[model samples]
Target: MEQITFSQLKKNLKKDTTGFKEIKLAVLGNCATQLLSHALRGYAYELKIALNVFDADYDQLEPQTLDPNSELFTFEPNYILIQLCSEKFQLEFCDLSPEEQESFADRVMARIQEYWRRVEARTKAPILQFDFIEIDDGVFGNFGLKTQKSFLYQIRKLNMLFSEAASKDKQVFPIALNSLSAQVGRDTFFDPQLFYIAKMPIQVDFLPQIAKRVFDTVEALVGHFRKCAVLDLDNTLWGGVVGDDGMEGIRIGELKDGKIYSDLQRYFKALRNRGILLAVCSKNEYDAAIRPFREHPEMVLREDDFVMFVANWEDKASNIRRIRETLNIGMDSIVFIDDNPFERNAVRSQIADLTVPELPPEPEKYLDFLRKSNLFETVSVSGEDAKRTQQYREEAQRTESAATFASYDEYLQSLEMVAEAKPFDSFHFARIAQLTQRSNQFNLRTIRYTESDIKSISEDDHFITLYFTLKDKFGDHGLISVVVLEKRDNGTLFINEFLMSCRVLKRGMEEFIINKIVNTAKENGFTLVEGEYIKTQKNAMVANLYTQHGFTDRGNGIFHADPNTYIFTPNFIQEN
Candidate 1:
């Protein structure tokens, strides 16, 4: 792949971004960031985001944040990106006394946090804090890492403190420039000549990578990210074809160069543990495809690890479509990995918007390539994420069991589905916020919220929030739905936000939720319940959702229901 030069990205500044989503970003830093400002915008243009940047003047990181009426506040950024270079910071560290130096990390964090507090107090935008890159001054050489006062130790310590601060405050998301510098050798990442000539810490050659990392987080925050990894079984997961290479013949554990596959498997398992779904797609016989996962001692990913497994002789593209449909996720939100160039291209040609990386022929580079691609970047993970595979497995079982019953309603009743719908609490704030961001297809109004927003909504008297959790004879669907009802001055209870996870769709959850909403409106003495369906490329599934729930479409996406006349929709779900 050809490198996207900073100059190349600069050319995109003039490109018309008419239809792109407008995402305001305020970039503030201590160093000269004029070039970086354009580079970020350019990269955003490439990603179909109209990134309106409020690039602050050089070294104005704090004053702009501290002032309540500053242009930074006026910009009203969706994200605030700060890049404080080590060149300026390390000089400040050198001026401090030995005692101050030892505690320099803590002192710096105190000031950094003050900036965060000032910005957050002014606006609800999430701050994207770019961490310090390495400064290999080589005074103490390798010993500097162990010395607390050393610039090497202090900078790394400062980065750790940034992470610690971000963990405590959900609004602060630290971008790992330190890791990026380390990945592409520090010398290649930073140019001493460039820093001395201009206050640029990062080389122009590396600015695109920095911009990409920032936008990766931005994309994820805006509810656009890959959620699943659809992998080929032969050679991609294992080393060779499991159909031809028998169970013992496959190169997985003890075979020559099998450690490569083993290491990659460990990484995939870690990904699954973190909430990303895994699906298997192979053009082999069903028995041959699944035998390794079930019987092979060397296999790290078991049959249960996959949410869906398609092992048919169909074209890989058709199989991937089935997997995407079964999962009910956008085709773009999946990453397909195959060792064969033909298979990868075949899928790429057939499936628009799908991500299919041309894997290296060399087996050893496969894991590193995918890691560097950063294919599955996501914003938040809840306890529900870790159990996603199991939940999907249960859904498959329910599907199978439904086939035995005569009617769908009878099947739903047989499961004895129970749901808990109640006001939002502090305990589920993270999950509630996550659903607002990730639940795309069923979302009405498509409004996104952060954890801080969720907390604020829960405490606001003008808003009524409800989060739903479903459990049945099969398994629990943890916190699948969120409704934010805003009390309006027009004698109506407005459905400000309505979204549910697609996994729980068509299971009477919508009926159950609508019933709850109408009842709440009646109890609150609001006769009119207003709703809307703002259409999107992916949310067509909910275009007529209001009409289906007995709400009259008043045209132009506006919907309304009279609570006094609202008939309770029949549902199999029992409110527990």
Candidate 2:
């Protein structure tokens, strides 16, 4: 792949906008960031995400953050990239004694915590903080790991502190600058001449790579990250076809050719643990395809690991569609990996939105390419993520049960549905933020919020934030719906955001929540409730949500409902 040159990026920035989905991104750093803005915009165009880059004044992060009326807040950025210069950051603490360095690191973390607290309190946008660059000490070369006071050791410790801070604070996302530097070779990535002349620490050549990393995070933040990875079985997952070669003939164990396949299975299993749905879409007999997983002792993945195992003599495109429908996700959310070029092209032709990566002819390059490609980037993960496979399996079971029932309503009722509505708390914060970032189709108003934003709303007296969790006879659907009601006045309430997971659609969940809204309004002194539905290309399914839920359409997608006139009953959903 040809890297985007700085000159090319500058030239591309002059082109007219293609009008992709717009995202406000602010870049703030001690190092020169003008080049990064152009490079990010150039790369983001490929992802169909229009990057509206706001280049903050060089080294003005403190002033921009401390001043409430600063341009950083005024710009209303969706993501703020804070790149910490290695020289500026490491020079202060590198010369200190071991004990002093520990104290200094704590103080630095405290300062960062304060900065985050102030910024988070002011804005809802999440901060993308870049960790310190790796700078080795000349004097303490080999002993740097043992010497805590050395520049190399202190910088490493600082990175750890940054990671810890980010883990605790949901709004702070740490970017591994050192890791990127290591990947591209430190000597090539750092430009000392440019650093002295233009105050640009990252080389002009590396700016594009840096920009790509930032955009990948932005992509994940806006919910473009893929959720499912569909794998082929025959030559893709193993050495040979199980049906033709038999279970004994298939290469999948500790042998030379089979070891790489086992390694690939391990990689997919790890992805499954991270909540990416693993699936099998193969052209073979079901029994033959599954026998390896069931009987092969060296196989790293078991039959239970995959959420959907589609083993049949069917077109790859159709099988992929079945996987998508079974998983209840968009076609774009599924990634199909196959060794056969014909199958890949066929699937790509049928599902235009599907991500069919061009596999390397060699299996050794598979894991590295997939990892570096950043197809499954994620901003956050919750406990519910680990249970994704089981959740989908339960959804599949529900689908099967729906077929057995005579009517849809009968199937819904027979499941004995229940919903628990509550305000956002520590336990529910992560999931609520995930839904805000992930939900697209059933989302009304199309507003995205970070965990800090949800926290602020939950604590504010004027906002009524509610998260609803659905449960049926099959299993529990954890924290699937979020409704944020802003009290405009004593007499009226405005729906600031109303988003629900698409998995709970057509289950009377909407009606159940509407009833809760009415009951809550009556309990309080509010007499009128209004809602606004902002149309996005993906959210057309919910364009008529407000009108359907008893809200009067007042021109231009605005809706108003009088609480007294609203009639709702919790007939199907048992409120908990």
Candidate 3:
């Protein structure tokens, strides 16, 4: 594969920019940025995202970032990428004494912190700051690693300072250009000719890579990350078919060329540890496929690692559909990996939204393919994510048990469910923000909030925020529901946003939540409680939610109910 050249990207800038997710980006830098903007838009289009870039003037990042009346503030971008030109620091570093270098670095750090605070106060957009690439003063050589007096030492110290500060900020995320440059050698990453001629520090060949990093970060912020890894058996898991080769003949474990399969299994297990759900979709006899997982001594993934194992001779597309149904997740949230091109093409043709990466013919390159492709980019992590595999495994058991019950209502009653509701705390703030960003089908209002926005709501006195956790005879479904109520001046409590996880649907939890809202309104001495159902392409299932729950439609997406006239009854869910 060849690198995308500057001439090609410039020629393709005016192509159609429709039919993709529109992302607004503001680029403020101390160098020329026109070419970078074109490259970013070009690469983003390939990833099914359309970028609208707002590039500031050359070397005016300070004025643009700090001034209230600047166009940067007016653009209201979803992200602000601040690229600090290395030239701005090179001259100062060459002249300062060892004591003066400390004071100078401190001043730079202070200025950066002040700039971040000013921008954050004005807008809710996240800040992405670029870390510095190495610049050698040529006098100290290897001694720069030990002495703070060296310019390279001071620059490294500044990078450390930036990272420490960003670690604590929920809204600030640093782009590690130092590490990126190291990966792609600095000689190839920077072009001195372009820097002197056009004031562009980054090379043309490196544009696509940097642009991908930027787009991946944006994709994560808007909740486009893949959640599940669907696997294939036979040649994919082992060397040959289990039905034909048998347990002793098939190549896995200690056999020749079998270590690659073991390495792949360890890789998948690592993904499972980081909250990616694993499942098997194979075409073999159920018992034959179960032999390796149950009896094989060298198997890295046990029967419990996978939430669902669909081992039959069904078509690959049909098995994938059943997996989607059982998991209760959107089709776009799956990443299907198969060793056979026929199976991969079949799934791709049937399901246009699913991501199916083409695997190499050899088994050794499987890990390399996964490492290079940023298919599972994420920006945040929580305790709930770590326990996701166990949670889904419990759900599978619950599904199997439901078959024994005569009716759906009988099954719901037998679970002995208990829901614990609480206000927003530090532990659950990240997960709540994540839910709001990702929950589309069941979300009312469809308003996306960042962690900082949620924190502000918790601190504000006019809003009441609560999250619900559900536990049944099966197991704990962590933090499944969120509700935000705003206190209005006319003694009406307005539901700002309400959403729930789709896994817990059709279980009478909705009725219990509405009853809880009504009771809270009565306790607060409010006259009327109102709710809304804004229509979106994905949220049509929730359009008539308020109407079904006994709220009169006041027109224009508004529904209101008088708290005194509302009659509430106990349901299957017991509130704690």
Candidate 4:
């Protein structure tokens, strides 16, 4: 089979990111061609994967280049690929007597095996092992039946070697073919279609395809993931500024100039559907900026579509900082998209790691640019993503209502919040773990666990994981909080983990959940509700939650909240 073409290689490499610490590659020379070498170099850029390519030649030649630190080893690669080419070559030959032929074969084969073992010992990085094309007489010329049989035998041996390597621990098989029908004479034996369909290994048919796959794989591996997409109001989501054009005069809807902005809004809607968190960071009067969202006829995105909105006349960077703080996500996880270049640059300068895309002046290219960037390609999404925007909108309304009350307790009472706590089952395990990993500000313990851990907890009756979905007059905050409690023998509810989405903070959600836990403990004949506060860089907001709930500081980052002393009353609505 021929090597993959350049275009196909590029396409495949763009599939993901490569941040792997160590990578091993085995190269077999079919001809005196450097095409594979050039391809490897190009792929390194696309995948961002650091690989040490070992080049081994089947035919002996004088050593031209050698570097102890270089990833490429020519002699060793040649021996390994040649030894695996035929069964006539014995593994014992690697330790045979020093006859001229035996010594040459033994030296090459032994060095390859030794180098591979040594490198494997040196690092824990994943290895991608490749087998060079094993060309025989039947592949090169119009050979008779015997020649074709021999050729098939060589190919079978190569396939076996690839299969064996793949079976080894942490070894990846990357099958690369130059073309679909490059060797037409040998088409009967080498079925390219079968290889592609069976997926025997991660195959790259052409150069462009290989490049693209490498890029994609490396991008995913890097894990430089971004979460929130912060948008600017006026000339961003819609065409014109609400302050200048008024609600009706804004360039939005099906009108001639409005279609572009309307389409842009639809694009954001699609992103939201895919679980990309949306927030607004604008320097406009809150009322004016929100007017179109509340009243515009053709607007697809409403106030409920944003997880957070900083619509005051604050500096753009400051507004972004506030959103980041409110959401409790890293600034690096945020992508600030604004129409104004100045605002974008300002955010880029102020927030060291924040991603600010250069906005195209023409409205038609905005969607295309974002699609090409692929900045929001996350690994997985949980139910929390879908409900996050609505939860934040509810939070904004709650904050506004809270201002009218004189005290925090009075405001919480006016809302009449009820937190329905149910034990986590299979349906909520993934979401629970996701909340634990993502929630920051109100996460008391901030101990992130995987889905498997959550599943294990569900299996054990001692562990009670409950998620709280809060709803009141404002709106429904779907699955806003989760608390994991472990029941001890002494009838005390030990809060193993507690996390509330930043969107639901300051809304009595935490207090309400704590009250529910206490009530559950009292009903179960438990004596006390205990919890711990683990110090983290991000969870300072929740460090004092135990104290607020009448939990006495018990030293060593532990607290004991007295159930009898806890007094929680809903002001706006009654418990269900």
Clashing pairs in 2: none
Q: State the lDDT of candidate 2 residue by residue for 262-321, as single tens digits.
A: 888888999999888999999999999999899988889999899999999989888888
Candidate topping lDDT: 1
- Cα lDDT computed for each candidate against the true fold: 0.89, 0.84, 0.84, 0.62
Candidate 3 overall Cα lDDT vs. reference?
0.84
Per-model TM-score, in order, reads 0.98, 0.93, 0.92, 0.56
Ranking by TM-score: 1, 2, 3, 4
lDDT (Cα, tens digit) per residue for candidate 4, span 1-576: 123466554454444445643445454432321334346645665445554555555322123122434333422331122112221232233344536332343344344445445544433232333343444434335442233234443344545555564444322323333222123223443444644453212223333443433333333333336778999978888887789888887888776588888888898988887677899888888999888888888998987788886798778888888888776677867899998988877778888878888868887788877765556754335766776666666666677777888998777676766667788877777677667656666778876655556677878989877877877767776777888889998778899988887766666566667778888777777888889999876678777878877788999989986666667634333445
Cα error, residue 123 of model 1, in Å, equals 0.6
Candidate 4 stretches greater than 4 Å from native:
1-227, 233-235, 238-263, 275-277, 282-314, 322-330, 359-365, 377-384, 487-493, 515-530, 547-555, 560-576
- Higher TM-score: candidate 1 or 4? 1
Candidate 3 stretches with Cα past 4 Å from truth are 1-12, 16-22, 44-50, 85-91, 100-109, 134-160, 176-179, 248-254
**Count of clashing pairs, candidate 2:** 0
Evaluate model 1: give its TM-score: 0.98
Summing lDDT over every window of 10 consecutive residues in candidate 2, give the lowest-scoring window: 1-10
Global CA lDDT computed for model 2: 0.84
